[model samples]
Target: MVVLAGIQEGKDAIVEEGGIVALVEAIEDGSVKGKEFAVLTLLQLCVESVRNQGLLVSEGGIPPLVALSQTGSVRAKHKMITRN
Candidate 1:
């Protein structure tokens, strides 16, 4: 929840400081609420900075996000679309 709140407040450093990896892990393995928050946070972070987008792509963030888009909830898929 801290990550989500941080991202919402435009904290790219949170993502840069390994938060992206944790979020990706959550998308892959966390509960529904976790995945939702993770994806939403990532989307917000990516939207806030191109650097965070690059960081996400470089950290192998795309595949899991694509996977989540394919299999996750409607909101998750929507978040993925917004991220792109």
Candidate 2:
């Protein structure tokens, strides 16, 4: 939830310091809520920083997000699409 709040407040530095790689990991292995929040946070972070967007794409964030869009819960899929 801290990540969620951080992103909502436009705290990209906080999120980046917390680690974009960690967020990618969460999207890969965390719970549904975790994945959703991670994706949302990444989306927000990416919006504010081209560097973060490049990091996400380079870290293999896309495939999992694509996979999640295919199989994740409706809400998760919705967040993925809307946020991306």
Candidate 3:
């Protein structure tokens, strides 16, 4: 999904289908790897698109992201920081 999100069409389809909300939910409740995947997908989805960025925020994505940044696995933290 992260790889797919890198494509414009893939990202738009995901967003149109409410994937942002789903991904946010995953970030809130998923396992360590799941959270990392969610954040990476969201990063790709939001990368040059303000609409997706706003959608991510509207879905309450920030608090969970902050928590993940602080307490998630070291790999996840590195991924978030590097946006990779």
lDDT of each: 0.77, 0.75, 0.91
TM-score-superior candidate, 2 or 3: 3
- Cα distance off (Å), candidate 3, residue 35: 0.7
The list of candidate 1 runs beyond 4 A from truth reads 2-10, 82-84
Candidate numbers sorted by lDDT from highest down: 3, 1, 2
**Cα misplacement distance, residue 70 of candidate 3 (Å):** 0.7
**C-alpha lDDT of residue 31 in model 1:** 94
Error of model 1, residue 6, in angstroms: 5.7
Q: Per-residue lDDT of 15-79 in model 2, one digit per residue for the tens?
A: 55665788788888999999888878777777767776788899888888888889888988888
Output candidate 3 Cα RMSD.
Answer: 0.7
User: Looking at candidate 3, what is the lDDT of residue 22?
Assistant: 93
Alpha carbon lDDT of residue 60, candidate 1?
87
Clashing residue pairs in candidate 2, if any? none
lDDT of 2: 0.75
For candidate 3, list the clashing residue pairs, or say none.
none
Task: For candidate 3, give the lDDT of residue 3.
Answer: 85
> Higher TM-score: candidate 1 or 3?
3
